[model samples]
Target: MTAFLLRKLGWAAATMLTVSILVYLALEVNVDDVAAKVLGQFSTGEQREAWLLANGYRDPLVLRYGRWLVAFLSGDWGLSSHFRAPVIEIIPARLGASLLLGACALLVMVPTALLLGVIAGMRPNSVMDRVVSVFAILSTSVPDFASAVLLSAIFVFWLGVLPGTSTMLTGFSLSELVLPVAVLALYSTGYLARITRTAMAEVMASHYVRTARLKGAGTFRIVFRHALRNALIVPATVVMMQVPWLLSGVIVVEVFFAYKGFGSLLYDAALNSDIYLIEACAMVSVVVVVLSQILSDLAYVWLNPRISLSGAERSAGVTDA
Candidate 1:
């Protein structure tokens, strides 16, 4: 376990380094006169040149990348030109908000998807299964933005029961979160449900389940105690992989709902050419993606003791020899 974690952590660092370099280069190539933009156009040529030199923007690309990487490692993410504040200061609250929203959506999505999937899988080809399959297909087919708009219109405009925008001044309230959460839940629930249903159905058809049935195991015990544990292996990984998507791919929903979260911050930063903020957001996304995969791997290992770690696999081979 220790060796596996160390190896994963090493890979994570390498991944982050590569991502940071690519993001930095992409921004540097696309945005001309970054120093002028950062120092302001009204500043004289000498001022811009001096600012660029002082910031090492005048250095070679490799040197500049190394400088930025070092600073990033030391928790100095640089200043946000958009907000006239440090990137560190601006991002934490936005990140927290995005995480909170994602958590709220997941809280609603997971159980609902699992319950519907279990029912459908256990009664394959029946009315309940067909209905769930249809709902899953329909929900997944709809674009997230369209789903957000439709939900917002129905709840905020037509019914007038919920707020149209999620922007909150005195922190968040359940009422303010209803439409946004509903949109996210609806968008993500379908994919999770489909995966769960497929896994559960496959597990239910396996020989062990047949043996259990032949052994006169109760339906509930066979399904819950035996099938569900193995079925969850795939779905657990699927759910973990959604973390990066929820963090970075919710831009449309955030913009539509006026939610002040990481997605919105990234959108605004890119639009305004806030290079530091954009880089920071990209790093956050990369980190989340890598970490979530690692987490998923760990969860799979924990859920199935029969699964061998790299070290353990080598040990088993030696023992066999």
Candidate 2:
């Protein structure tokens, strides 16, 4: 397990480094334009040249990338042109807001999805199965934006109980968080439920389940001890894998609900062409995605410990020894 984690972390680092290089090269496309955009069109040629020289655009690509990478490692993520603040300072607040929202969504979504799926899979062809399947399909079929709009119309316009925007200007507010979290949870639940349902159904049909039944095991024991544990392996990994999807979904949901999260911040940076902010956001996103996959792999192994042996261990001929 230690080896696995060390390997995954190394890959995550490499992925971030590669993404950084790509981001830097993309920004290097038109140094003159970046300077002009940052300094406004009315700035003189000397101003652009001065900006380029100051930012190390005049240096070799290798040196510039090395400096940028070192600075990024040292927590200097550059300055945001739009916010007129340090990129490091701006990103953490937005990222924290997003993480809070995501944590809430996951708390609500995961158990609900697993319960619905397990209930449906317990009796695959029964009336309950059909009902849960239909619900899952309908929920997953609708996009996040549409869900947000529909939810807002119902909660904000018809009921008038909850706030439409999830802006955390002062601090956290449960009422404001309702619609955004609901939208994210509802959008993802259907797909995850389907996965769990399939896994549960397969486990319920496996020979071990039959053997448990033949050995006079109670329905509860067969379901919980024998079946549910194996069924969770796939769903657990998938649940961890949803982090990136949730982040992507946040872009639409955050914008629609006026939530100042990492996704919406990225949107703002792109619209304003804040290259520094964009780079920071991109790097952060890559890190999140790679880290999520690592978590997924860890979950998979945790659920099935027999496969925890690394290739190096497997090749050592321990069985003969």
Candidate 3:
């Protein structure tokens, strides 16, 4: 376990470094271009140059990147030109909001998908299976923005029960979050359910499951012990893969709902070309992606009895032997 974690952390660091380099080069290559962006396109060349010089943007590229990296590591995540505040100061609340929204959506999506999928798989070609199949296709077909608008119209305009926007300006309001969460959950649930259903069906048809049936094992015991863990392996990885999608989807939903979250911050940064904030958002996003993958792998190790660090290492050693 310790060795596996160390290896995952190493790969995560390497991934973050690569993403940071690419994002920095892409967004920060020409100092004058960034200066013009930060200063506004209409600003005079002299004003832009002066602003660049004042902010130490004239430094060599390598030295500047090194400085920026050190400062980022030490928590001095440069000022956001768009917000006129430090990037570090701005990211926490926005990150928290995105996390909360994502957690709620997953809380709704995971169990629902897993349950619907397992039920469908247990009786392939039955009415329940047909229902789950149709539901998956329909849900996965709709885009997040479209669903967001549709739900808003239904809940906000027609019924007049839910808020149209999730701004939550005064404080965090569950009522305001309902539409946004619903949109995210509804959009993601289908794709995951399909994957789960396939895995469950395959597992149910496996030799061991048939053997269990012949042995007259209790249905509950057979499913919980002989099938569920193996069935969940694929969906666990898919769920982690969904993390990036969910985060990216937040950009559209957050903007539509006027929610002040990480996704909105990323959108605003890109819209205004707020270089520091963009870099911060990019790196932070990669961090989240890599970390989620690590957690998924840990879950993988648990769900898959055949896979383990020490066992795999010993197997490799025996292979060499």
Candidate 4:
């Protein structure tokens, strides 16, 4: 596991470097002449050139990238053009809110998805199975933005039971997060439930499940202790993959609910053409995605001993000797 973690960390560093390059190039395409933009039409051409040169804008692209990379490594993520604050400082404040929202959404999604999946898989052709299948299909069909709007109308407008917008601070209660969390949870539950159901169904049909049943094991014990544990392996991987997806894809949901999360911050940065903030956001997102993939791979090894001994050994640092 130590060797495996080190390998993953190395890959993560490489991935971040690539992501930084891409983000830098993307931001470069946009107008980065902050001096020109801020100085305006009244400034003469020579004055603008002088200002740009003084700020090191005259440097080569490679030099600029090297400088940015060095600064980023040292915890200075550059200054935001719009907010006029360091990217590092602005990001962490919003990241906390995003993490809180993601946690709440996962809390609501995981158990509900697992329960529905297990029940459906236990009796494949039953009415409950059909109902769950239908719901899963419907849940995945609508996009998150539409769901957010529909939820807002029903829960906030019609029922007035939850706040339409969330003011998520350090001291904010969970009630402030309920509506946004529910929207995100409901949007993701269908996909996870379907994946779980499929995995569980396959496990239920295995020979060991039949043997356990024939040995007079109770249905709950046979399902939960044996089949469900193995069935959860795939779904758990899917759940881990959702971390990056939620982190980035929650932009629309966050915008709709006026929730101040990393997603919302990214959106604002893009709209305002804040290159520094955008780069920071993109880098953070890429890091999250790569780390999530690494975690999912490790989970696959941990869940299935056979896999750990076989294919996982090659890349996961598990030696045959």
Best by lDDT: 3
136-164: candidate 3 lDDT, tens digit per residue: 99998999999988998899999999988
Q: Can you write out model 4's per-residue Cα lDDT over 222-291, one digit (the tens) per residue?
A: 9878998799877877888889889866788788878888999999998886777888889888887888
Ranking by lDDT: 3, 2, 1, 4
Whole-structure CA lDDT of model 4: 0.81
Give one digit per residue, the lDDT tens place, for model 2 in 1-321: 677778778988888988899999998557898898787778999999999998888888788889988998899988788889999999988999999999999999999999998988888988988888888889988999899989989989999999989887777889999999999999778888888899999999999999999999998899888889889877887787789998899999899999999999999998998988999899999989988877777666667676654632342223213
Q: Quick one: best TM-score, which candidate?
A: 2
lDDT of each prediction vs. the true structure?
Answer: 0.83, 0.86, 0.87, 0.81
Clashes of 1: 0
TM-score of each: 0.93, 0.94, 0.92, 0.91
Model 1 C-alpha lDDT per residue in residues 113-207, reported as the tens digit of each score: 98888888887888988988999999989988888878878887899899888898777678988887888888678888888888889999999
Per-prediction RMSD in angstroms? Answer: 4.3, 4.4, 3.9, 3.8
In model 2, the runs with Cα more than 4 Å from the true position are 309-321
